[model samples]
Target: MLWLSCVDETAPALPAAWLIATDAQPANLPERSALRRSLACKVLARQFGLPDAAVEIGHEPAGRPLILAPQGSGLHLSLATRSGLVAIALAPRPVGVDVEQVAPASEPPLAMLHPEERRWLASLPASARPETFAQLWSAKEAYVKALGIGFARAPESFAVRLDGAGRFVVDGARNGGPASGFVRLTKNGGHESMAAAFIVLDQA
Candidate 1:
């Protein structure tokens, strides 16, 4: 399951399956890195019933976080941080999570989106474009991260759209196969909100 919380809140309790958490954005680069590892360790500790110090995090050549000490844990995770929030996801299989502040963009970056996604956003009312753009971007980020490729695969190479059931769906040719995820708006405070997405790919 996915979970969301603030950085100031107590460390989140882990679930038996997948887990996602969001918190207040740390103030600097060092803090961000530390927070990401801290959260990852916490999740690993609880999920595997191990001590926090026993769970170590390293980075793959592609910058994906890896479990260094627990040799055969069979786990995967991804992290994202934006203007006012930071997010992390942990899963028994590969998983990705992204969170971004929801703010209007006077000039939405249509060129970065897949053609079908661009057209879908164009079909929405002007007032709805900003949030829709956030949703699409977050979903795209989450999907690529799950693939462990990041932007090595172009953002415009795939499409993210809301289906009739209002669930986020991804399509287009990509290295990873058979993925699933969701994008949703999260209220952070009185006037601030965020868009977050969590994606998991099928085991090979």
Candidate 2:
């Protein structure tokens, strides 16, 4: 299951919801960075009924989410940000999440893209301008988050193209079957945040 939450940073210790309890704080960077990380782990540990001290939450060498299990259960999480809001995604399998503040790109970050990305982003209609590019950024971020490589893996190294059907195209690979899970994007704090999870469901 996936959940999205927005919390006022000033407010401390809000109640936990169904799947996970999130202590979200919309604070500035440097001040809220550690708080955001702590809150995410706290909420996740609370979800699994683990004590705060028992759960070890650290950062990967590449600055990815690091979770130490006390019960030997398998789970993966990813977190990313843009300006204010910090987003988190959790799943039994591997999962990735990212949040970006959407704005009028006086100059979009497209200049940071390679030839292939430039061509892909340019192919979209003007009507789909920022939204399409925002989707692409969020999707790639989530994919890298899933891989646990973080930014060590180039965003352009993989491609995420969204079609009219709301499906995803990755590295010229389309998910037309029931293989991988879907991505969820929503507007939060005037930013675009996305979450992707791959679930292995057992059928009867």
Candidate 3:
């Protein structure tokens, strides 16, 4: 029961999720990427025949995603947003997702990378920095967000290295845990977005 969605940033036809953003002040909020993420889940609820108003979405203290109320028995979901594209995934188990615009990362994101990561960033040509960093950043962010720990763990705690084009390896050994994952980048709204998920283990 995994579901994923990509919304056109410039979609002339607005979907239901955008309403979550619209309720806020007109000029104060950043229109495009700054919207709250649960909007995507709200859209999914509608698609699943549930009332969007009944859904309860909250965040962990660490800023990781959370489900405040018990989700319906049949589904669990994850979402990612970048530039103007939004991706949503639904499955029968816990899930996590992240989307970062692939451009020059703001200073904050770069600062989150460890010295090792900085070295890796420095190794790449100036022109290649954004793409390389974004790919690796999104992957790890997705993973941690999946774990629901967020910044509680340092980004460098896990080791991520990219070799061949479209190939990535993540090693969490340094993070004191054996968690890791892979990702493939796709073009969304003319920006690079990476999506990753773990195959849910069926306990039943």
Q: Give candidate 3's TM-score.
A: 0.60
| Pairs in steric clash, model 3 | 2-90, 3-89, 3-90, 5-88
| Worst-scoring 10-residue span by lDDT in model 3 | 14-23
Compose the digit string of candidate 2's lDDT tens values, residues 4-105.
Answer: 454322112212111222234446665556655665666666666766667666677876676776546565656555444556555565566665444544
Model 3 bad stretches (over 4 Å) = 1-3, 6-38, 46-56, 60-62, 67-70, 74-76, 104-111, 163-167, 173-177, 186-204
Which of 1 and 3 is the better model by TM-score? 1
- TM-score of model 1 relative to the true fold? 0.81
| TM-score winner between candidates 2 and 3 | 2
lDDT of each: 0.71, 0.52, 0.51
Sort the predicted structures by lDDT, highest score first.
Answer: 1, 2, 3
Candidate 2 local lDDT, residue 47: 60
Better of 1 and 2 by TM-score: 1
Q: lDDT tens digits, residues 47-133, model 3?
A: 555666666655556654455544644555455555545555444544455555556444435567867778878877877787677
Q: How big is the positional error of residue 49 in model 3, measured in Å on the Cα after superposition?
A: 4.2
Quote the lDDT for 110 in model 2: 80
**TM-scores across all candidates?**
0.81, 0.67, 0.60
